[model samples]
Target: MEKIRLGKTGMMVTRLGFGGIPIQRLTEAEAVKVVQRCLDLGVNYIDTANGYTTSEERIGKAVKGRRHDVYIATKTFPGDAEMVEKNLELSLKRLDTDYIDLYQFHSVNDMDTLNRILDPENGLYRIFEKAKKAGKIRHIGITSHQMDAAKAEVKTGKFETIMFPFNFITSEPAKELLPLCREHDMGFIVMKPLAGGMLDNATLCFKYLLQFPDVVSIPGIEKIQEIDEIAAIYEGPHNITSAERKEMKRMTDELGTRFCRRCEYCQPCAQGIPISLIMTFPSFVKRLPPDWYLKGGFIPEAMEKAAECTECGECEEKCPFNLPIREMIKESYSLYEQVKAANTK
Candidate 1:
């Protein structure tokens, strides 16, 4: 595995880091096994979030005796200083570690939220500074789905790293954010590298991302097979073949019209629908087995929520990718309803 310096934080992380989201769906033992496989394959950067249910605990158990061998990064949703402090302490406890390698403000979406978080009096940045000073966390970072917000945060030079979505489908980061990170010597972490599983060719995705030396893509993994597949990429040629380029174009064209990147900009629906999840459920249905889908929490609850979407157009307005969210919700609901009925039968 290839290693690169993670900006000013100074942690040398693997190009292919382990994302802990999918592990939430795995049994503790299963999650541990997958994480161990990642380590065995020389993957050293592990990222999870407090909001990811059991991911932090599973990673904690997985890295118990060998914490020094791996770098752990976890995040908390933006909040007041007290909430941020509380979550940081909880994350330390959950990870069974004295200090976190990198702690992030999770999913910061807008300028207003960013302003509030950077405020000196009650901001989470102060909490993170205090934590770093007290040795609870070594570095502070931020993850955002909004490119504008991420760019602004990067320009401030306050964060050690900035994580955002980057893939064949979403390449806007390449134009500005990528160069900005390099300019500032900030670590650039790529999330949703596979475009939330809408992009079927993992090899092509990895090849595309590997072309950029400064950015690290953390694709969520659950199975040992996923670990093996991703790890094997390091052994072969990293070049994107012409055939692969054609395939990438085909996939991009097919998915460009309707795919939801799960940026969560279209949130707080007036009808109380999880618009991003509902738009994304169809991809999960296609990628996962029926049993895993049932056990993995993609139940009819998503459909029930989708049914509540009143075609209010708020989600569409906020969507940066300009997805037809209302129409996508209808299609996803139809698919979920069919799956629900089949399972009941």
Candidate 2:
């Protein structure tokens, strides 16, 4: 709805880019309708990832004859040169486009991962450079769930844009990342602006984020109602009552500490469990349907595995966000067990 210069890339992307993750759950026909509605409403920036299961294919289909009108940004989780090259080709093919406006390294979390990406011999820089030369990718970018890693990447002066989680609760770090990005003339695309839908009132959050001059917030929307609501914010003055801000603060305080960001730093369970992925199930249930999770989609395989946690405190020490990993996992397991039992009848 609101338009801003996307960092150093100099493209005027709408403040509400269509985040592509949520569309993965929708059928192709449904996704097409939602995307078309977004187009009719003037929200033109579309961001997708190669990992978001058939999302690119759907976009390719939805935007078939109209691809050139919209800005397409897609990401891949490629850690090496070969993989990066492979992914780029695959993304291009899937989207039915020759060049992507922005191609980013997805879900980068640490310094080592950053180094591996920029390394000339083994990293993606060479691949990105080659792509740019060949006119396959117009700009290079990186996406990180962790602000620290994103900040580190911005310092390298290599990226045209940087994508990181930017929301009301996690905005403090932007005080640091934003200036560096502005100084370098790099674009800043924000992910998770709604705190993964925990921030229930999207209007205030969108307005709050638009006040920052150089940042763009792309809250993924799967429904036409959300598309219309976001578009409406653009036509009017962005305002939030003092009382509403207080309410937002209170709600975030209640949920911020307990919710997992899926950073996956606290891992390598002795019993081979996907702790971060399992913890996210509750949010997924809330986002989509309670039935799927209750029917066993979200149940942690760690029944005995979760019961095995000895409160060693090792995971807490490793977590970037300092999530109460063991406690949250236990809670998820218990809640899911009850839901699973109820669904059996």
Candidate 3:
């Protein structure tokens, strides 16, 4: 319901925008219906990516003929100039749009990658400049999970906005990244507003984030109920009551910083390990009934995958949070075994 300028880009968008990840799980018709419902409720910004499988395609289909009603921001995985151009064309076709409002360099997580992409002579940025002039994209932005990469990008002044993981538990961005965004007049778009669905207190989380006027959060949505719930949050008070504060503290204390946010950056695991889902298994068990896993479905299947892990460390290398993913997977598998043993009686 409330709007803010996305920093120097100067594009006005609502505080609660649409995150384009979770909807990839929905069918085209279901995704279209839910996304249209979200727009009808006054949420005007949608962030999608070429890497998110069917996300861009679904959003594109959902917003057909109503492009003027929302801001569509999508990211491309960094690549050579030609590859970058090809990615752009594919995005435009999939999004069914000739021009994009904000195009970001997705997951530029290290200095080497950042430097390579920013190179004027041979880097992919040249193509973005070309696209901007051609009216294919209006603004350039960057998304990163690494603090160093994000800060370097800000100093380059090449990006108009920065999307990063920010939430009550993972609040480190506030100390440096948030201020840098303010200093540079860059838009700070929060990618994991609900800490990748690990935090169940959506009401408190959204209310807490609303306290900062400069920060905009795009929590992934797939259901129409979530759309209506977020709209209600906008209408509700932003202040945290004492009970809510206590609950927030309990959650923060319980989670600390080691848990996964289910970002899926460590995907394509060499052993086909579903690292994010396995990492989130503990949280899932807690949320469900005690015997949910005892029914013997995906948990056993995932545990089989987890047990096959060679500890190749490939997933850890790609993880932005630097989590001990292999160890966590093992722990989850052990928990699964414990439940199985208990159920044998």
Give Cα-based local distance difference scores for all models: 0.86, 0.78, 0.84
Q: Which of candidates 1 and 2 is the stronger one according to TM-score?
A: 1
User: Which residue pairs collide in model 1, if any?
Assistant: none
Model 2, TM vs. native: 0.86
Residue 69's lDDT in candidate 2? 75
Q: Rank the candidates by lDDT, best first.
A: 1, 3, 2
lDDT of 2 by residue, 1-345 (tens): 557888768888877788887877788899988888877777778999887767898888888888877899999885666777888999999999988999888888888888887787757777888898999999989888766677888899989898887777766546888888888898888888887776777877787786786777777888999878877875677777788789777866887777776666776666566677666756665555444344332244534356667777787888877788878878877767776677576
Q: Model 1 over residues 1-345: C-alpha lDDT tens digits?
A: 899999988889999999988887678999999999999899999999987778899999999899999999999998767777789889999999999999999988788989998887877788889889998899999999877788999998999999999998887889999999989989999998888777868898899998898777899997899879988886679998899999888988888877776667778788888777777787667545556555445455666867767787988989877888888889888888788789879
How big is the positional error of residue 42 in model 2, measured in Å on the Cα after superposition? Answer: 1.1
Highest TM-score among the candidates is held by which one?
1
Better model by lDDT: candidate 1 vs candidate 2: 1
Q: What is the lDDT of candidate 1?
A: 0.86
| Top-lDDT structure, candidate number | 1
The clash count for each model shown is: 0, 4, 0
Error of 1 at 310 (Å): 4.5
Per-residue accuracy of model 3 over 305-337 as CA lDDT, tens digit each: 888999999888888877888788889888877
